[model samples]
Target: MNNLDLQKLLDEMTLEEKIDQLLQLAPAFFEGANSAGQITGPLEGLDLAVENVRRTGSVLGVGGAEEAIHIQEAYLRHNRLNIPLLMMADVVHGYRTIFPVPLAMGSSWDVELVRQAAAIAAKEAAVAGIHVTFSPMADLTRDPRWGRVMESTGEDPWLNGQFARAFVRGYQGEGIANEPYKIAACIKHFAAYGAAEGGRDYNTVDMSEWMRREFYMPSYRAALEEGCEMVMTSFNTVDGIPATGNRRLMRELLRKEWGFDGVLISDWGAVKEMIAHGVAEDEKECALKAIEAGVDIEMMSSCYPHHLQELIASGAVDVQLVNEAVMRILQLKHKLGLFENPHRYADSVAEREILLNEQHLAAAHEAALKSSVLLKNERNVLPLAKDAKVALIGPFATSDDLLGPWSCMGKREEAVTLAAGMLGVADPNTVTAIGCGVEHIPDEELAAMVEAANSAEVVVLALGEDSEMSGEAGCRANIQLPDRQLELVKRVRALGKPLVAVLFNGRPLDLHGVLDEADAVLEAWYPGTRGGAAIAELLYGEANPSGRLTMSFPHSVGQVSVYYNAFNTGRPKDDPNAQVRYVSQYLDIPNEPMLPFGYGLSYSSFRYGEAALSSPLIRAEEKLLLTVTVTNVGERAGSETVQLYVRDIAGETVRPMRELKAFRKIMLEAGETKEIEFEINEPMLRYHHADLSYKSDPGKFEAMVGPNSKEVQALSFELV
Candidate 1:
């Protein structure tokens, strides 16, 4: 529909109808609506009436195309305006062909691969009749204690921005209005939801504006600038006001400043939760504040439908506010071409043919293979010979819990198991045993596991958190592996057998015992449907492990928020010779994480030459080309991600000790060397000032190039 037609439709809508259009309901409501105008079938918990349910604008979490078609048909028959229901779901990583979690995908450091995985997800979701996906969560997180960290890419602003744009491009390819098998992408949790206090979910976030701009807001801006069609408000407060009702955050900053005219949605019931946040008095106040703050749609909340009409009548809310919000919703429906074809992209036959097809499975396999990081390889114990006898012990050995949380439409029973993958690759003599559950081990199970370990040439200990232990509400106070699994490790160690540990988890954990006890360690984080097959190939030397750590692995949960980009203190601990007690240092533990960002290992070793610069000085808009030679010194062919880090020596305010500016992932044959180059300019050194000005200071700058954040060679340059 054109602008005139949409405006006419909006003008024709009654005040009650306009208010109802801002509400989103589940499929149950539509299935329950009757000709007598009474809603049935277990929807008594909601405050919505039959008339409002029929004219509801959107549906949340519809299962498949068949259900979506049924809902749309039922909805249109009752809908006076004939506006089809907008279908949406949380398609975070993948739809049917589950790929690695976003955190693991960030470890791959391959943006093109991220784009491909999202495109595959979009195709599958579109066939399932989903019109919008709440995905590519752009929250920059530093604490692994937060279970939702699995949804974020990593802790870095620049890298998160890169992944954010890639997701938007993949989901709404070209544009959703012009494409068929694509869905509108909704970049979520608008403000800093990741910086929840104490790493607890939905906790308070208190950060200065400068800090917010410098670290947390870049990725959201990148997604919106990439033409994302929707934004979901976070459940946390911004500057003491809940983001759902904070006019400064939603209306002023997001709409006027950023020019995001797309739909702005409240995260499931966030608008109503404002009352729980102690800011609003009741449902009427909730409706007034959220509408004034520019929330175009309310998800799974009845505050708008319950009190919006009364608020407008009492002059608490202008009717024009409702009109504008309704217009945005109508424009989105028009953009999706829903008016012309109510059943857009809903085909049961196409859903079967396209969901989890061979090509998608292949892509998922590649994502899993690259996203699995080799954290430790003490000796050449990896690349196990196919003829060697192997014993796979622990709960994950035969379990198919590879699909992490929010795995939309993925079935765990259909996933490949580690035992099956190992049996397919290794010799017939390989044996498997379930030594313990995630947290408990029986005496008989322990004895059986030890017997199998003694008979094998090597033992592969599959251990990590359960799928239930991470994602949304999966926060934990202690992130260490279960004590029983650690005990299992000690028992296997007593057997004097070569041990390899394979971890399947969502967030980074304190790998104290496992890291030290195992001869080799692979951080295979929730590798999706084909994860077992991918791990099997990497174990048997069929493929090389190339992924790196995006978030730092803390040495202990006590050091919860440890990350690479930290500020330097006045009294430093840099000088090893200085024995001063006044320095900022920990008495019992080291300041560094056990494994830093960009830290990963390959079977083939890489050596970096000294970094060379074209010039020592650069001005604004001038480019300084820095080059380094990376050679595959070891005997195997592999891939390596060369990272470029920059440090601003002095600035308007203090800057991080080091910030990741850029990186390049390249494949190398044995004994082959390639020159890697990166351009440095003034823009790379800019940061938000105390007064909220974004610019760089003219001073000395240091550049470092290496495989990871910690181990690198540095060079100094001047920026004027």
Candidate 2:
């Protein structure tokens, strides 16, 4: 149906029908009994309420190909208007063939891999009859402490935008409106949810309009430009107004100013939670505020279905606003071809054929390998000889704990463990011992593992947070390895063997112990099902690790808000005496992060040469060419991520000390030299001024090129 047809349908619907269109019912798979034995509302069974809602108009959240077809049949049989139900699922990473989380994928700096991951996710999700996926969360999160940061691409807006476009193209392949199996991509958390106060999930976001426009809004815009069909509103309040009810953000800016024609869905229960935000007195008021703010769908929030009509009748919201929202929802269904053929995606044959296909597994393996960053390889202790008697220590050594959280579809039993993969590459006599669990293990077990390590030629200790330690509702009180696990590492190190620490985590860990003790450290951040295979490849010199740190690793949780791009304080903590005054520096630890963003090591070494600009001065319409030489100094072939960072130097408002402008991941043979160049246009140099205009100031600028934030070669340029 065209927009005119959707608008005509909306015009003819009753208030009840319009309200029904706005509500999204939960899937039967999510409604069931809790561990407490009490019936915990629909997280897993087909409820009578779901059937009633389907009978009224249309429903959402029907799962699997067969069940989706059944729901479509019911909607056709029972709905008075014969409107088709839309099925939505949270296909965050992969549907069944799991890939590394978004943050890990971002470290690869490979757009094609990112696209392929989303494409596989869409294929599996579509096979299950899902017409829409709420994914490609484009939030620019700098703080690793935020549990949801793992869900985002990374800290830089440009990189996030690149991945956002790739994901949108991948999910809505060849346009969602035309493809039978393609699902609509819902670019999420509309604005600045990543800047939540203190990195706490769902906390209020307080940022200047300048910051919001320059850094936060770019990813959303990129997703829209890439043809995303829907957007999910964030749960947190921005400038004291809940996103679900913020008319200035949702209506005035997003819709009117940016011309976003796609549907806007609220995050789960966000509309009802407006009462908790102290913005709405009741669900009725919440419905009114959200509808007026231009939210098209209320996900898992009963407020719209129960109270929208009452609010509309009271003149608290206009009928036109209701019609507009309903029209957008119907348009999305039309785009999904739901109105014409409701059962188009409900193919049982495709469902069984697509999930965990060989191609998907291969892609997952490639992603896992690319995301595994070789953080430290002191004296080249890694690439352990295939014939060496290696001792695989730590609980995760044999456990499938590398598969991180929000992995609803991944089977731990199917994942390859480090010990299994290592044994595949090493001699049959290779020793394996469980040194310590990520969380709990007896002291005697640790001692026995350490003794085995002493008998081996080399020891590989796999350490990291448990699978449940990061993701939604998995916030940590401390961002370090569990003290017991660290103690186990200390004991293993005392064995006097060549030690390699493989970290399996969802976020950057405080690796002070690994840095000081381990001979080699590989940051395998929750490498998916093929995690073990990837680790083995990196270990045996089959693949060179090239992934970089997308987020900073803080020295301590006390330095919680640390990032490469931070506003300089009037009293900078540059001097030891200034640190004594207790300005921004912690007394016990320095303000710097343990590992800066864009920091990663390889099996081989790299040296960054001096940076040069093509032109020292340029006009608004012109561009600057930045060139730098990167040489592979080590004896082995490897890849290096050459990063380009820029400082505003002077602006109308204070700016971050440095911002990532461009990055290129280059593969070089031993002793090879590569000249990496970046074209810096207005967008690269632009920042939000006090007036909220994204403009580049005509002043002196500093362009730096290097391996990471701290190590760089700088050159000054004048923008005239």
Candidate 3:
């Protein structure tokens, strides 16, 4: 219904009825079987709640396709209002044909693949009778210690924004109002939840507005710009205010500043948690605070239904605010065509037909291939020669640990193991050994695998954390390979064979020993469902590895705050003579990361020529074009990621030594050369001034072009 019609209906309802319309409760019937098993039905019980919603005009959660159809039919039969219930599900990753976690997808830097994965996920979810998916997490994480990092695209704002738009487009697809088997995409953890202190989940975020705007807000903006249907508030407090009750953030910034018109849902039980945050005195206060803050839905909170009416009746909240919230919910339902055909999405045959289709599997394979970062390939030791007798050793070599966390929709039985993939590509005589269980195994099993390694010409040792080690509630005290796994690798290396180590992980790990011992290393990450096939293709020269690291790999877990973009210390430790002084450098290790952000190696090497600027000086309104020529110097065909970075030599405030501005991934045959250019505009140069204005100061700037942050070709430019 339009606003006029909705308001006309509201005029005929009592204040109690109007307040009830703003509240939503999950149906008790078929509650436990919902995706993730976190959903629960209403207070009075399933049947009672259904009857109550029928009379009260509230929403209920329908379990799946069959249940959704039954509930809709029952509501139509019993209700005078005939209001439809909203079916929701946690469709994280793929609904049935699972894809890689968002972090792995971000590493791919392939936006289209990410879109296809989400599109398939939405297709399966919609077929299952889900109206909305809590997905496309746009949180910008810099801390690997945060377990939720698995759910987010890695730390870059620009890359996160691109992925955000792709996911929103994929889920909502053209428009949810018209498209069949499409669900609304909820862009979540609203703002800066990724900046959780100490990398702990649900920790406080303390950052300046400048940092929030520059590093965290872009993805949310992008999601909104792409017409995301809903937004979920984060659990963390921002600047000492819980995000669930922050009126300035939700009302002023999100709705007013950015013009987000979508339904704003609080994170799971976040509305009630406001009491724990000390922002509310009780459930009544929590309801008043959240609704007044512009939140439209309370996911599993129950505070909205229990306390909102009392709060509104007592004049704690305006009646119009309650009406506005109800209007938003009804508008979404109207757009979904729920009133006309509530059971439109309730088809069991479609559910069986759409989930895990062949096209979805192909997309997952392409995503895995693109997301595999070739961290090191010394002596061109990859694309293992055909018919070569290779030894596959490691706990992960035969294990189904390839499916990373948040892949509940993925089945382990169907997952292809590294051993299986390699055997499929290699000759019949390919040797294999399980050096250690990816998680846990007996010492005897480790010894046997190491013995088998002695007979092979080359060994491929897959290592790193299992699927459960790097997701939500999976925070680690030490970000390194388990001691047992490391020891196993050492024993396997004693066999005197060239070894290639493949890492299957969610976050960056401290792998200094493997770096030194292995002839080559590939940070495959948790490559998702077709991970094995993708790794095998890259290993046997069927595919070229082009992915770059989105996060820095620390030398040790102690280097917790490590990143490529960090402000230079006042006492810079550049000199060898100053190494002993207590400065930014660690006594035992270098300040540099084990592998800098954007660092990756290919079978072929690329040589970067000197960089050139179109103009030596640029005015406030003018832009400059920075160009450089990169040549493939090695003998094999490969791809190189050309990165453009900028440094402000002088600024009103201190600046990071380098910041990534633009990057391009280029493919080249042996001896091929290409000239790549990046445009530097006013926005690229702008930063928050001391007075809080966003502007570029008239000063000297350095433009650097290179393969990664640590190695770069530099040129000077002036912005006036």
Using lDDT as the measure, the top candidate is 1
Against the hidden reference, what TM-scores do the models get?
A: 0.98, 0.94, 0.93
**TM accuracy, model 2:** 0.94
Question: Per model, how many backbone clashes are there?
Answer: 0, 9, 3
Cα lDDT of all candidates, in order?
Answer: 0.90, 0.81, 0.79
Instruction: List the candidate numbers ranked by lDDT, top first.
Output: 1, 2, 3
Off by over 4 Å in 1: 32-45, 433-436, 575-579
Instruction: Please list the residue runs of candidate 2 whose C-alpha ends up more than 4 Å from where it truly belongs after superposition.
Output: 29-52, 55-63, 431-436, 575-584
**What's model 3's lDDT at 123?**
83
lDDT: worst 10-residue window of model 3: 39-48
> Candidate 3 regions off by >4 Å?
9-64, 71-80, 178-180, 433-436, 575-582
Query: Tens digit of lDDT per residue, candidate 3, span 538-559?
Result: 9888888888888888888788
| Residue 550, candidate 1: alpha-carbon lDDT | 92
- What are the per-residue Cα lDDT tens digits for candidate 2 across 299-380? 7667777777777778777888878887877877787787888876668888888888788889999999999888788878
Best by TM-score: 1
